[model samples]
Target: MKIGEIAKAAGVSTSRIRFYEREGIIPAAERGANGYRNYPADLIALLRFIEQAQHLGFTLREISEVETGVGEHIVSCTDALAMLAKKRDTITALIAEAQDRKRRIEALMAELEANRPAPRAAG
Candidate 1:
């Protein structure tokens, strides 16, 4: 399919797909005789996995490592789960910190709004 079709199917923009290709996150697309880019159907699944993993705090490099099996090997499910658990804990901590910061900002904004001077009466 064409780039537009792929972007529509993946629910992302054409620029993002192009960026992913340029970033080496995915393999280069095959070129047709007409000089058009032809991508594999399986690329959709890979793109979805990349997006979902990123939502869970995985970096592009980390996603690439897992997808390519290039990092330190995990010998068992336990080892895999241990790594996942660690990431989950880190995500939780970051969420808590973000919430605390949001509360502090809201409090400051409320105070500032409360101190705002009233508008003068119309002449």
Candidate 2:
């Protein structure tokens, strides 16, 4: 497949695909005789995996590490699990902080509501 075809199949823009290639997130495409990029069909699956990992809050660096490890056959299930656990803990902390801020805002709103001026009596 070509870059456009791969991008369409991966649900990403052509520029994004190119950027991923430049960033080493995915392997570079083979160049055809006409100088056009030719990507393997498997590239689409790899791109989708990258998209999913990003959605799951994995940074590019983290994704790169995993990709490199997988490519080298050095990454184990336990290593992946550890990375996930760290991410989960970070997200949990962020959620707690957000909830605390929400509670504070609600409290301020209640205070403002209580102190609001009453209606004036008719003359």
Candidate 3:
């Protein structure tokens, strides 16, 4: 397919597809005689995978690791799992920190409420 067709089918802009090719998130496309990009049909699936990974909070670097693994057969399930476990731990810590912050804010609100000043009598 042409770049425009693939971009439309993949629900991404053509520039984004170009960016992915440049970033090595997707394999470089073959150039036609007119210098237009020619992408494979399977490119849509890869784009979807990237979009889903991003939605799951994976960084572009992390997505690039998976992309490179799929493209080059360099990463094993064991390696991927180890990475996922580390990400999970990081996310867990962040959640805990957010909860702590929320609790502190709630406590401060309660204290402020309890110590509210009495209203003066109307003149």
| Counted clashes in each candidate structure | 0, 0, 0
TM-score of 1: 0.61
Q: Each candidate's TM vs. the true structure? A: 0.61, 0.76, 0.78
Candidate 2 clashes: the total is: 0
Q: Write the per-residue lDDT of candidate 2 for residues 1-123, one digit (tens) a residue.
A: 999999999899999999999998888999999999999887776787678779999998888887333332334678768988999999999999999999999999999999999989999
* Candidate 2: stretches off by over 4 Å: 8-11, 69-75
- Where's the lowest-lDDT run of ten residues in candidate 3? 66-75
What is every candidate's alpha-carbon RMSD to the true fold?
6.2, 3.1, 3.1
Give the TM-score comparing model 3 with the true structure, all chains together: 0.78
**Candidate models: Cα lDDT each:** 0.76, 0.85, 0.82
* Candidate 1 lDDT for residue 57: 77
Clashing pairs in 3: none
Q: Which residues of candidate 1, in runs, are more than 4 Å off?
A: 68-83, 93-123
> Where does candidate 2 have its weakest 10-residue lDDT segment?
67-76
